[model samples]
Target: MLPSLAFLIVSCNLQPVSAAGTDVVSCVFPFVFDGRSYSSCTKDGAIDEQLWCGTTSNYDEDGQWKHCSLQEHGGSSGGQPCIFPFVYKNQTYYTCTEEENRGFWCATTRNYDRDHKWSYCADIRLDANPKGPCVFPFIYNQTSYSSCTTDGMSNKKPWCSLTNNYDIDLQWTYCEPSGGKRKRRCEGRWGPFDTPV
Candidate 1:
């Protein structure tokens, strides 16, 4: 007398989430639950192995967690964000996808079949620290910029890319102040490739 799998899944999706209708809260890496340490999201205590993370740095104390995507240790790890239209197993994906019951995941690189880098999609969206590691070759004013720029400005403030390809995950970052540090770290003259486009 069990419900159909599809029905159950639908019901689960309909359940109220504490983070619903709010900006996705970034997961606290290396959290703890049940007297164990977990550097990534876990399904341990969650029904149906749904991935979850602590609202605070420690789960044991907060006891507050929200359902996250079954991402394989996703989020800013290595600063490699998901790139759309990614090639995987001779196929291309324009958005998040599920492979072998691992829930929705995306290739952190443009060619997953090559570098083989990927992570689970976030609970709401594959977004965190929106600035992200600069992806370069990004479009700002309908013009593609392969590197940081201070174009079309009066203050000469430095700027950089946030999206990988502009055509995919096309978005920019906040601040004209902290933007320089991100550029230096990710676009410096030497060893400035924490993120690749």
Candidate 2:
């Protein structure tokens, strides 16, 4: 009785399809299913094909075609929507959407490196102000600094630091000596430092 019950469980999990000839041609890597390309292939049977993520092919303990594990998205559960947040440099971004299997959505942010500032995600609805660059201010070793865009400047650079000590709401200022005393000589292309009027 136990053997019969086990056979029924196994049969219910197996998908039935019309079997073709034994010489079935396996699907190639990056298999396109429902218009999306999968990175890997699992089992290649006469009647059905199983494709997933990772390498182009899968191997079994006996060196045969097998199904590789599916890639798991962050915060995913029971077919529910997943919004995966990732931080780069210092800014936060999200990925994945309510729709299943759809690829990442694209958006602009200040979390870029020296090259680009755009990233792909599932959605960008959470972005309050996508048009403007994101600014991040931080303090280190009793000195405050800010990272902001230089769009309107003459250089048209993406990132530049405030010349003055950074504050949450205070105005920016140039780096000056403390106690109104001239320490080391200010030497740069801007010429010698002059006392503020």
Candidate 3:
């Protein structure tokens, strides 16, 4: 004799996945198998789609799975050291680090004084050396400073803080007026900061 529809479903397409858990199989077609909805094979039943449920305590924390609300390639704060309250393309997202789950800091707040359009926050570091040409208003202590004449501080103590700490006078390369050189480089006359380098 043919069993009842529900009984037939349980026997054929749907089955309890485990004895202790409520998880069961509903359908095999289209890859959705969770038994949350009635079998689509039945009349008046719409196709049930699969929805991702976060892992429970039963699952290992490291092995657990969680659904992300952000779009693919979009920003998120699932990790630590993430940048908070960040917006992109009209959508707000928190910058997260996949390394160990952390939040990110602002570049401007860290004395960057530049754009803040980065996707991650853990990229901040002190050993960063910029290649090629760069704009000014940069911050540097002593070891990083190469020259000081451009900023109008030849004595090095007045311009750079590194020399001031040592209290040493900078050696100034002066040009003699009787040397017949009409142009002044660093000695008597002031140079133009507005001049393009």
lDDT of 3 by residue, 2-96 (tens): 23324433455642232211222112211111322321122222123222222322211222222211221212322223233233333222222
User: Candidate 2 — which residues are off by over 4 angstroms?
Assistant: 1-38, 41-46, 52-79, 84-197
How much is 133 displaced in model 1, in angstroms? 2.1
Q: Point to the candidate with the largest TM-score.
A: 1
Give the Å error, residue 175, model 1: 26
The parts of candidate 1 lying over 4 Å away from their true place are 1-23, 70-197
Please list all clashing residue pairs in model 2, or write none if there are none: 104-121, 105-121, 105-122, 164-173
- Between candidates 1 and 3, which one is better according to lDDT? 1
TM-scores for all predictions: 0.32, 0.19, 0.15
Local lDDT at 135 for model 2 = 26
lDDT tens readout by residue for model 2, 1-197: 12221242255453222121111122224443333444334232323344322122321111122233233222212222322222344443233222222333222432323323332231212221112112245432345445433332344423222233223322221222223433211111121222111
Ordered from best to worst lDDT, the candidate numbers read 1, 2, 3
- Where's the lowest-lDDT run of ten residues in candidate 2? 183-192
